[model samples]
Target: MNDQAARLRRMIEDKHPRSDNKSNNIQENSKPEKLSANRGPRTIAITSGKGGVGKTNLTVNLAIALGNMGKRVIIIDADMGMANVDILLGTTSRINLMSLLESDVALEDVLLRGPYGVSYISGGSGMEHAMELTSTERDILFRKLAGCEEWADIILIDTGAGIGGNVLDFISAADEVLLITTPEPTALTDAYAVMKGYSSISDNPNLKLIVNRVIDEPEIREVVGTLSRTAERFLKISVECLGYIYDDQMMIKSVRQQVPVMAGYPESISSRCILSIAKGLLNGHQEKVKLGWRGFLKRIFRS
Candidate 1:
């Protein structure tokens, strides 16, 4: 193995050292079988085909909306090199996932609490190292992440834009993938490309689209219809419209102030749109697929 891989393996083995034979036998005998579906936290990856489409904004506000509804939510800023979740929330972390992986710091030590009772883990620049993690290392990392399942009902991953390998790995591993786009032709084209790319690689990928910056209901329907029809026809995949956010000045103001629109302007049109989407998800308006964290890890290592 190369230097990076060797370092990663050492980190994993050190974090979870093997037990003696007698202790291992006793532990194996006492451990219970894995629980059935619908047990662990739900994981949703918010991504886009291209950048500057308000994907992170939606992730932050949507997570707060869910938290307001009494759901325990954690947002993992998985954008890697271009992380801005901390900037959007107006907070700073002395450590991030990279610090945890490369050193002995515990994962909980790196978790930062954001506004509205939502917890988040900043990916920082360590995401580049994630792409190089061997299968064994990834499994160990996922097992470490599984600990977060105890404290959250929902884990929302804010993935980087575009179809890079890191982005694809996170999307494919998520229980649900929320693809955000604008009304622009380029955004729509890239959104379709993301759906097509994911469809080709994953079996029955749970995909949903959120149209941002819509001017009116007519425009929303038109945009959703066009994309939905194209995806159904060309990709042979079904893309559901989770919801849309209207273009609003309050949203821009909130961003400038480093507060989520949901918290700063709950009565704003954009806030209402995000709340409606959160309610839709909670009410089971969307299809139910419970992969949980273990399944997510399996998919990640397999990829």
Candidate 2:
């Protein structure tokens, strides 16, 4: 195998030890098959209760960190109306998802390669137009996305903020959701609003919190603890603390440079935090659900 594939194999072995053949056989036979073998990548939706909580920043950097660890990562800039992922990566896309939906363009044609070999689909204003697509058109879009399953190990959907129908559709379809928030009261409240809204519609949504722009350890604990407690108490949902990003100047500099901090300043505090979160994801700190692209498409198009 090549170096990257070999490294990925080693990481997977270290994280998920081999089970005995007999036990593995028994487990396989005992469980009902839910996901298809063609369902290749794990879909993760990174969203927030409101905008300006650094959702896109975290999404881009986290994808880069995961890619550095030998995982093939694809980021879908699902914020169709106000897509800035291309701007953030300092790369311009000649076409976006809109082109795919409106014409005979293939998925690969719309994908843009960003820094650190990360591939992304810029939604541009196409996402705003997605909700109005006819049934056949929506099915075509989903099938195109499903074709990406073989190319990525992880698909990060950087969804638009707030409790819009499109945002909820993407979040509900994902295997897991990472809710981003800051210590600001409004941010926290909006985050809670998102959780509450989601709980009302979906059953047992996999929700995790990423506290961004934390100034100190105490602030991290305070924000995470308060949000966790509120989610459990009111929504009856258990919110896992994925990780936190510190308030670092390097992040601002990286943004100005239009590069992810993980690529621009690997040693920066925020970059390190993103690496930690990626490790947490790989180490199975959260539950692994069988939901994949096919299931995601079903959920999205049905709604």
**Reference-based TM-score of each model:** 0.83, 0.84
lDDT of 2 by residue, 1-303 (tens): 233664565467447744533222113323212223333588899999979889899989988888878777888998875667887888777677777675557665676666566678888765556667888878787777665665678889999999975888778878888999999999999999889887787765888899999999999999999999998999888888989999999999999999889999999999999999999889864555657766776776652
List the global CA lDDT of all models: 0.78, 0.79
Q: How many clashes in each structure?
A: 0, 0
Q: Scored by Cα lDDT, where does model 2 land?
A: 0.79
> What lDDT is reached at residue 134 by model 2?
84
**Distance from true location, Cα of 170 in model 1, Å:** 1.2
Model 2: weakest 10-residue lDDT segment is: 24-33
After the best TM-score superposition of candidate 2, give how far the Cα of residue 141 lies from its true spot, in angstroms.
Answer: 1.1
By TM-score, who's the top model here? Answer: 2
